[model samples]
Target: MIWPFNRKTSTETGAEYYIRDAAIADAKTLVDFKHRIWRDMFGHLKDEAFFTQAEATTDEQVKFWQSRISRGDTVWMAEDLRDRLVGTLHATTKHSEHTAEFVAAHALGELHELRYFYLTAATAETTIGTELIRTAIGDQPAITWLMGHAPLVETNLRQAGFEPLGEPIDPSDAPWKGIPRQAMVRQ
Candidate 1:
């Protein structure tokens, strides 16, 4: 449903937009938003070959978001006054196996890298990205592994009390062929 921007609702104030859990029905919208954001954020990252191949396709993104929702992960989105989703956050519940192994790798006696958090690019002024990170962190204090990259992602992550753990790492696990993916971690 298109959220009325100026209309008063329990979800948000008139002056600003708000965030909510993404639904299966939002698949198409999410895909479109994803394409736009990716094109903007990574359009200039590498060679044209990489850009063309890694470009966001509607079908691919829809399937991805659908899978994320079906897997029980939550996708939070921010709608502008026009009811358009300008920003998005995708997060999975705290990891068990990875966190345990990470602790061992780091040699920490007791470590808790709770959940993994990610955000999509949109208008920088809205601060929706920042709010999404904050909300997720607030909901799950155990989340210790927030992940993202880019200058904006770093800024938002820092605002949420996350520290720079290291350089960004590629997020794509499959042989997607051309699109390059990278992510930064915060604890």
Candidate 2:
């Protein structure tokens, strides 16, 4: 968590967990966290109709995360005091074309995409999520996909200066087919 509620500090506090850059060794843990949180956020991941291309390939997710880390895009993982995975934050230079178009239409300039910032249900009300976000993007302008299912997260983003753009960024793949995703931007 962000100790003393200081966004300026990046050091781990004497809280429940600490955040750090994800390493290659963390692939499996990271993948597991993604699935668990997906279930927490989206509920129908196991329904099979929503698709599993991404879910079916743990190795691909690992490689994708490794690529993000190697490319130095913002990818941070949170671990509890016992060193167990608890949360994650990823901001990427890569985003959907719709996001790009909306940014261009509004003249928002270059902005990183806050791909996903997830904290387990246990850490939801804590400062760890905020810490991860501040560490990942600081005060830089950025965009992100907000789950309509997560009101508190959206509220936090709004407080951080992100607002919904256009109608909503349409889901491109099967995995995201039924989930409502809005492109929130900060210029």
Candidate 3:
């Protein structure tokens, strides 16, 4: 289901932006945006060699996002006045018993995982990201893995009513290995 929302750029400026369900055709753009945002936010934490070896190429990211979009994962995109994609949020229902167990432990029902939530630097100054997150998680209890370094994301989630729960889990084999990530939940 698509959750549509509209918000003005900033209180001082009245430019409007739209947030809607992502389409398969948006996969490439979404991937590119993700890459740019990721590098902008976390690149300084890693060396050039690590990025070269760990980051997925544009084609790989395109295929990954396309598959997720086609599979009907709850993905939302934020677009500017010109309809350029600037932000994205994706969520998936809990599928694994282990994840379900974690949700149960947190006293959250039928949990949905916040898979990817990001906004371009330009759009980050706006309320678009918060609205996208709020709409995406709508009446369902949700959980997310948050990097320790991403204070902005943590603050956003907390403002949306999510709280840190459990200990930080190590993403051993992922590109984010060695980065501390904590699980957060909102009921």
lDDT by residue (42-139, candidate 1, tens digit) is: 55644555445545466786787788788876777777655778777665444566555554565555333433233444456656666876665563
Return the candidate ranking by lDDT, descending: 3, 2, 1
Please report the candidate that would top TM-score against the real structure. Answer: 2
lDDT of 2 by residue, 27-127 (tens): 77888788767766777433643336557887888888777667666569888766777778788767678778777887888898887677666676777
Instruction: Evaluate all candidate structures by whole-model CA lDDT and list the values in order.
Output: 0.56, 0.73, 0.73
Q: Per-residue lDDT for 81-142 in model 3, tens only?
A: 76877777887885455567677776677778886787665664677767888788775778
lDDT of 3: 0.73
Clashing pairs in 2: none
Better of 2 and 3 by TM-score: 2
Q: Per-residue lDDT for 16 in model 1?
A: 59
Residue-level lDDT for 128 in candidate 3: 77
